[model samples]
Target: MQEKIKAFMDEVRSRNGHEPEFLQAVQEVADTVIPYIADNEIYNGKNILLRMVEPERLISFRVAWVDDDGEIHVNRGYRIQMNSAIGPYKGGLRFHPTVNASILKFLAFEQVFKNSLTTLPMGGGKGGSDFDPKGKSDDEVMRFCHAFMAELFRHIGPFTDIPAGDIGVGAREIGFLFGMYKRIQNEFTGVLTGKGLSWGGSKIRPEATGYGTVYFAQDMLLTKNDDIDGKTVVISGSGNVAQYAAEKTLQLGGKVVTLSDSGGYIYDKKGIDEEKLAFVMDLKNNKRGRISEYVDQYPSAEYHKGKTPWEVPCDIALPCATQNELNGEDATTLIKNGCICVAEGANMPSTLDAVHTFQDAKILFAPGKASNAGGVATSGLEMSQNSLRISWTREEVDERLKGIMKDIHDSCIEHGIEADGYCNYVKGANIAGFVKVADAMLAQGVI
Candidate 1:
């Protein structure tokens, strides 16, 4: 099995050698899914995994726009339509300086399984541009988004491909992109998620990913007769996912101790309650300040320069930052500090070594595909509401999101349990997500 997995990955690496991130994503999936395909007669000889690795469509274009300085700027944009076996392409669009084909491909590949785990009729796709929204004037950001959508609009639509927000892309960016799409296409359709509620956005869309991540972690704890209540939670990232994750943790009686940004992390041992979390939301969303500013507001907290929050003592740790933010050393520190649960709120936030360290410790660890799926699941709900021309209440949407998280948890358990009675969420998520798309691809035949 090891040889087979290595052989498969070697073939993948040959094509994607320059794309470390994409290769890592594929390697993780291949490690678990290949063994399943070997044992399952129906999947053998089909090369289903091989086909899934290759995107059905990859579109790249140039986005040109004027900045506030009246200077013309050009950025590379990409859309990786990974798979449409289960439904039309569905995923998020990121607008950050780090956006590239490799990163987008990794994200799109992970999206395939994440969407499948949601049990929603949405396939995996991802698009983005290497444009930094941070520090840019709203008008400058709007111009960039419009220019990006100007080219992206031709390849996406309500029924074809729908994009939500990720990383540097958020409600403001989504509004700008959607406005351009509507004007150019001459249609007010559900072409994008994360819109304002007055428009086509669904309730609890912003909170879905963070809340769902906590919900998934709570379920994982429940397996061992544990819960989030009274647990000290350490969370990384101060963005939408991390802020709301802190919010949900507080609501569930968990003491959230930390939140971070690119600059550094801030640790408040007294815990980040609703008030502090609100400050964080404003600090990141409105003020657009560094997380180190959090210490200025709350003098009790200490800010660590150029460090992650994993070193803090806690019962739970949620890595809601970027890919490969958590490494083996960080994982070791968390384990040594008595962290029992680590749920990923960001896609591939943990390095491969970090993941192995966590799994080897036999602690509860939920992958982003299973734990952070609420964002996309709620986006699916938004799509449904748009298609039906109806809106669900906040309570209704929240309940549905909870149900979806629970269902994803159950699916992970059904597939991820090993002979030692420990659940391997990574393996479970990969295999469980693989079976659905693989079956759909099998039934549809090769494209």
Candidate 2:
């Protein structure tokens, strides 16, 4: 195990030239798998783990679109097909300024195990663009989506890679992308998830991540006979995942006091209720405006520029924003304020130091791979529905999602619980996710 870790580290350093984000992501999984591989003879000498770490194919292309002012804007788009021993590649396409090859590779690498953890018959992949969708107009966004899909459609299909929404990509963006794909391919099919319900979209798809995060957290709390009721929660990001997380928290009798964007964060000690949250939805989703306007609309709320919500104090924190949004300092503040549980709704939201802080504090922290897997799990369901040429009811989808979350929680405990009866969800998640992919890779005879 030590030798493999050294070799892997050396290989990464030699090729990637000290890319910390990519190394950090690779090391996290390597730390889990090396020992497991060493212990199991079947996995030894197979090079399956080595091959799994590298992507099968990576696509990068120029996305050129004309804006409302008739000017040409160009952005880079990426799709990292990380692994496919299990099934076709499945993941989300983020459209943030931070999108890059390294970031997408890290995300796709993580998605390999995450999809495996869902117990679904889907492989892992991730794609996104460097185009910031923040201030783009409807027509501009449509044009951009069409242009992006013009290249991406060739690489994706219902039985092949399927892409869904992420940071900047939402239903509207998915609509435009799917529309372009349909036009190019000249067919109506489920090549994407998170579609409008009227289309081939599955029900509860939009709410899956947030609801599943809370549900997984609920399962964690139930280990100690606790629940979300009457708890003070702080959630970051005002996007779909954050909004739905806040909604589910409130539905479970929790008080959610914070929501943020790249601009800043909003702290409402009185809890972001349905009406206030509705205003946020209108602000971000409908109006496509800045989060600062949330303060203007609700005078009681205070918006802090260039700050996170951890200082506000809470019992739970769900980081639904982009990767590395929660650093060690935020983790310390949350611990100081007595945060008990942290579940990730976004992929790799917590930095390494923050993760260590949570572990040191002995707080129940479920990594995104185990906790926020509902989105992709339901995506697998969407695939199933498409294969059968049918659509599922909202209640049916929601029920299936809940059951999957519970199953993932159980899988974590089954694999990650230590001798002291403390469940190390991180270890559990990595090991459980790894076992499936590792076995499949081994059986495939060194592919």
Candidate 3:
């Protein structure tokens, strides 16, 4: 079994040797899914994994736009239509300088499983550009988005492929992209999630991922007859996922003591309350300021330069930051600090070693595919609403999001239970997700 998995992975490495991020994502799934495939004859003897690794469609194009200074800037854009056997190509579009084939492929690979775990009819895909939105004027950003979407519009549609927001792409960016798509196609469709509510966006879509991450962690605690009512949480990243994760934690009576950006993390021993979190929202969303300014508004907080929040002792940890941000050492530190639960809000936020360490320690750990499916799940919901041409209320959307997270948690337990009764979330997530996509692939008969 080991030899087979290794042989398959060796081929993966040969094809994607230059793509460490994508290779890492593939290896994680291969580690868990191969064993399950070996045990299931239905999935065995099929090169499904091989086909899954290769995307169904990978589109690359050039995006050219004029800056505010009227200077022309060209950037590369891509959309990896990973798989659509289950449904349309559904995923987020990230705009960051680090956006490359490797990272997008990794994200798209992870999205296949993540979207599957959502219990929604959505396949996996991811697209983005190396165009950084930071420090760019609204006009500049709009121009870039327009240029990018001009190319992307040809490939996506409501029932074909749906793209949402990630990282630097937010509601503002979504509006621009959708406007371009609508303008180009001359049609109003739900070709994208995370649209403005005034148009067709779903309620609570912004908070779904973070809220669902915390909800999954809350479910993890429930198995031990514990709760998040008083647990301290350390979260990385202050982006949409981190901000809303903290919001949900506060609502659940959890003390969120830390939120970080790439610059560093801010430790607020006083806990970032709703009011403080609102300040953070304004600071990051409107002001576009660094997290260090958090200390200025609330003197009780201390900003740690060039550090992550993992060093802070907490009962729970949510790595909402980018991939590989939490390493083995960080995992060790969290476990040693008495952390019991770790839910990933970002795609593959923990390294392979960090994940192994958590698994070895028998701690409750939920991978992003399971823990952070809320974003895309809600995107799926938005699609439904758009198809129906009606919208659900906030309460309706929130309840659905909570239910989906609970379902994902239950599914993890169903597949991830070990001999000693410990649930390996990564293993459970990979297998449960693989079963759905693999069966669909099999049914389609090598298409």
Candidate 4:
């Protein structure tokens, strides 16, 4: 570790206590940025890294709502307005049972750089509640979302901070939150992304993360004279990200054999075709159902209990679940089964050990900050559309998204091409994201 990074880590430890996960996230970015800062003297000793590590503000509040049973429930809501030197705070609101200060902080910190790497005029922030949307009735979810937004709307705006969807927050949740924002503010604006198309939502917003992941993976494969066509893909998670990742993989002529949920994975030997994927979308998205439902619907598919999809043999793997879902053992299993590429569709889905395993095995691995940046990148686009008072067509938005993914891929190679002629995408993404914000911070001086 570089001295500046070591000092920053020490500072973090002193202030935030010894939280291992938070430290790991910060260290990952620092390791990449310190080298670049050393090479560029203007950035050295500027404390940009330190400033980037600490958020501009963190807002936590109590969310009170009524369940379907008419029982009052209380949950914690958080919004870390991380940075805004380059532009307004921009990120997602994840509503999962596992959310906490440390988790949101790590996510917000990572978002700062991820937004920068998109070359979009946006900063970093993350907000969410510990409320789980799964198994909740629509009315119950609406009440929770309305409660969450009642507190959050005050901190966000079209030009201030923008939040999108992540993990447990989706179109349904966004609609509920947006309704509350509009009802309270008495204005119709782009306060949130991932909204329904009827309410100024951009086309392809829901599919961006997964589509972007595959697009990033496609760019990576292109470097080695390959494409997604005819490739075997194994993707984890059956959420929006994983579903669209599977959709795009098939669109690109790739065969996806596996899709998983928290319960387990479903393996389809003949590949999860478009019809099967639609069934899955209906089951998970519409019905709020389980992975086992897919097995019951499709007799050919085999459902495995308490196991991830990585055990399947594949040329590509996309982990679209929550953080640290893929560990060292999973990485080893995928690599041993001839997995050549692993792209993250979820935030920090791969553990440190898993990342090292992929890197050591020379598998093309793209970190979430780069691979899943499509969602935020498109969020930035949505902001632009709102500002311009025009909505782009799905094809136009998708085309722009593809361009942004390619640009991110190019940016990574430009910054982090390693000695072995492989692009260290993680380093590239962090450095590229850092330099932009660092320059902006330097120009503005300390804040």
**Tell me, what's the RMSD of every candidate?**
0.7, 1.3, 0.7, 1.3
What C-alpha lDDT does candidate 1 achieve relative to the native structure? 0.95
lDDT of 2 by residue, 128-243 (tens): 99999877888999999999999999999988899988888899999999999999999988899888888878888888999999999999999999999999999999888899
After best superposition, candidate 3 residue 61: deviation in angstroms? 0.7
Candidate 1, residues 244-266, lDDT tens digits: the string is: 89999989999999999988899
**Model 3 — TM-score against the truth?**
0.99
In candidate 3 the C-alpha lDDT for residue 444 amounts to 92
How displaced is residue 243 in candidate 1, in Å? 0.6
In candidate 4, how many Å is residue 361 off? 1.8
TM-scores of all predicted structures: 0.99, 0.97, 0.99, 0.97
| lDDT scores in order | 0.95, 0.90, 0.94, 0.91
* Candidate 3, residue 120: how far the Cα is off, in Å: 1.0
Q: Which regions in candidate 3 have their CA more than 4 angstroms from the true location?
A: none
- Compared with the true structure, the alpha-carbon lDDT of candidate 3 equals 0.94
1 or 4: which has the higher lDDT?
1
